[model samples]
Target: MEFAKPLPNYLVTRYHGWKATSYQENKGWYRRLATEGQRPRAMVISCCDSRVHVTSIFGADQGEFFIHRNIANLVPPYQPDGDHHGTSATVEYAVTALQVSHLIVLGHSQCGGVQGCIDMCKGHAPQLEEKTSFVGRWMDILKPKYQLVQDIEDEEQQARQLERQSVVASLENLMTFPFVDEKVRDGSLSLHGLWTDIGEGGLECYDPKLELFTKV
Candidate 1:
């Protein structure tokens, strides 16, 4: 018999222990948070990648930052047709329920979904089919941004440029929500695009001055 090791030993064990310890340390934090009383200063739209943990990235406590994550962190424009819009629902909760003041879209380098979109734009990836998996559907959000980034020369520069633009695209999509647009226009809300370069351990922000990402 091939004995399989326990699944939680590597990652889940440590994470669960941390959660328990955090609750022990801060007794009322989770309790208060569960009561639907959120006063978070910022809401982070992050990728579903295990490595791109929002709480760890910002060193946040249990209820510090309102977070939403999806494949590639893509946010589709708001619609009311009762779609499987986990991202859109989270945005609505953050903006309308929580009333978060700042919202940041965090995109990371070498995103698999974005890469698939780039490949599709280059005619290397397959089109939508019944066999098209979840990743293919998720990456469809990046089609336009990928094409826009390709207009730039320099292959190395093109990838970096696309990553940053994808972040901006997601941020722009956040405005499709009526509440987000209203708050943004009234100066009560601000949007920022952040890119995390995993290879370099650097967090970069969209620099309006240079029109590129700069390490922060």
Candidate 2:
């Protein structure tokens, strides 16, 4: 393929720094990981937001978590049709192949994707509603949850509520996968939902019994 542009110099510089410092300092660890392969304990599904760093939040090391990012941190319901499904494929590999013990859906406040979903559902984003809009089609997974927050009179509050709802929706959707369901039933896997406050740096974990998110 023809090149649109060369790699950015800043990113190249950062890569060089990491190669010299992090890679050199952890050469043995990196070598072991490369030789033994990854045995990650958890799979975290989070938004593509640049602010959300899964490893930084958990203080995790390399190969500790199998992370996947997508808009709104939403998981679509299982559809067995033979077609492209990135999130589903990752979940399958994690559950069946990797046998990850925990699967966490991480949502965050001030999520642009969640806001976009709210806008698209409210008829404010015509561009997203178009058939060709991949983001629009992907976000349709969270559209139903919008009804849960529509009655909130405060717009910002409603958007935040919907952001948390994205986590709940994803957790529910995760159970729809047969492999995930089987593993959970067999006591081999667990599911979790979490939401983060970007500005305050607060983390909340969802309690299924109370159907609420409490600070962690």
Candidate 3:
């Protein structure tokens, strides 16, 4: 990391504030966490959107939830090709190593990644269709989902539908992992899908029985 610019001043200041408050309020808890290691009960897969705050929305404390974030909160199908796979690795560690009981795919409204998938599928984003563009290639996983919503007449509604589909797609992909499938079948693990409305601050959980997202 030579010749890189200095870290931003605001981030440095925020770190100091967090350190002082965290140590002052929960020094014992922090020490215990460091000594015992983490044992989060749930794992949350969410979009890498600034507006989608998993901890804040769930009121979770430190060491409670194992969180993983990607462009659109997608979990690609299990591919043990011995290549680089960040999301898959995270899921493997969470389920096999951590033994987390719940795995949740959390989608959100106004997701730029989802919108990019829509644009790429519609031939509107050429850069994303290029092989060199990492985002475009990563979003390819969600391209098939666009077809499910393409028939929707309203542009906003279509985008929203794709966002929800991202969650469902991730859930389906999670089941492709043999360990995940085994645990889920034996009742040791459960899968969940969720969507959030950024503007309305509303949360919805997907009901597999009805195949719809209802407010939580």
Candidate 4:
């Protein structure tokens, strides 16, 4: 039952290199973090895309941010049906357990997940329409928001709009959780939406009041 495969050699080599250099340099910091446990100030929900490095973008260190990555960075509405809910569990732990002051939904340009949602909604992706497609079901969370950007004539513009909308959609879903809502109402937690440009290195923050993303 245990025979399968081993980790790739490249990963093992990199781990050894880190253990020799970065790990040794920050050994004390890592030990302290291990003993004290994580008390991250903020929790960032972002896409699983490898290019979206939240830590590098924010220049953060270990134990500074509680980060969760998933396809499209989506948060489904609260449903206490006694089912497995990974994102919901993460949010609950971050807000109610860790008491993180900030909860950020980070979106980015050229997001494949958002583009898949657009394609599925436009009836262009038949494979995604299949009920057996896990990705299709996951992208369903953002399917409704496609209507907002459907009118844009340019494909690039429409994709960009939907990418930003994904962040807003996640933020909206986060509030549906009772614990998250309670903390927000009590001024103990704050929600934020951010969209970044991978090629241009541009960052924008959403303003709930202005109803738009502004450059930071």
Candidate 5:
């Protein structure tokens, strides 16, 4: 298509460099992965935020995790009459097709998507309230949880609370899928909620028993 653009020079150069070094060093492994196909043990649903590096956080190697990224790392409640459900489709593939044992919803502090939801909820960003705004509609999935933090007098604290809530909310929504529900109930699949502090490099996992996020 005439509309398609070429890769930027820097990215093209980086690709060539990686091919010559990393890819060559792991040529045998890459060949095996290409031949055998992937069998990632875990599926990680995380935000599209550029700073949130899902692999770097865990020091994971190639094909270790099946990763899906979306704004706020959300998983919408199951809707069978699907028209266009990207997140839902990925979850279906990960759970039913890939048979991934663990599904983790990863959220982060200072998340722009979470902050956008906060702004939209507080009526500070009128443009987001319009139906034509895709981000606004996506943020609606987390709108209800805003009520949990709105009364907080501190803005940073409020946003931080909602960030964690996003992870918890997505984990709940993941269970809404029948396949996920059945597997989780049978102890075949597990779900996790995690939040990361970007600047401090701290990670916290939600303790379902304590109903709070404890430092990792």
Candidate 6:
């Protein structure tokens, strides 16, 4: 618990420095966004990783994206009390509350969560049971995708392929939400998959035809 003091010190110094300029100039914008209303047109389901910041990468200000971040940006299939319900709640809010037109499931390169999923599937990590850690249970959502990408000969290519496949899986899981399914069927909602390689600054879009993430 003593280590927790470092977080407060970090926030008081590092966070203050980052927010000082923005808060001085954009105070009104922040107040309005916090008090009035939020009408974000898109909902982005992304990783909780600090490096894969969707808003910063997309140049979106506050109230632009109804954001939800979880391990590996994975959305588990709809099931009652399945312990992976955040994705469902976020999708519901986006479709029913905010009525967002676009739902983006963003994946990225060198994802530790996705790598955990891969390792679990390969029997290198502990088995998924009731006592498994949250990450273990959460990353279970990407197990199938990890298995599908297992045959690649190149290690780097395989990691990229695993991330891409997880994106596709999460997109499918998006449709499991009743509201999302109804809207997609009625031509009101669209789901997109994006893979961002932070080191290379490359963003790719998932191609349905080739079943791959092609550079955008």
TM-scores of all predicted structures: 0.83, 0.98, 0.97, 0.98, 0.98, 0.89
Model 2 lDDT tens row, 97-206? 99999999999999999999999988999999999999999889999999999999899999999999999999999889998999899999999999999889999999
Compared with the true structure, the alpha-carbon lDDT of candidate 3 equals 0.95
lDDT of 1 at 120: 72
Off by over 4 Å in 5: none
* Highest-TM-score candidate: 5
Candidate 6 per-residue C-alpha lDDT over 25-95 given as tens digits, one digit per residue, 9 for 90 to 100: 89899899889899998999988888997988899988999999988888888786755466787778889
**Which is superior by lDDT, 1 or 2?**
2
Taking every candidate in turn, the Cα RMSD to the unseen true structure, in Å, is 3.9, 0.9, 0.9, 0.9, 0.7, 2.6
TM-score of 1: 0.83
Per-residue CA lDDT of candidate 1, range 158-215, in tens?
Answer: 7777777778788778788889999999999999889998777789988766877787
Ten-residue stretch with the least lDDT total in model 6: 123-132
Q: Candidate 4: where are CA atoms >4 Å away?
A: none
Global lDDT scores for all candidate models: 0.81, 0.95, 0.95, 0.95, 0.95, 0.84
Clashing pairs in 3: none
Return the clash pairs for model 6, or none: none
State the displacement of the C-alpha of residue 65, model 2, in Å, after optimal TM-score superposition.
Answer: 0.4
lDDT of 2 at 76: 93
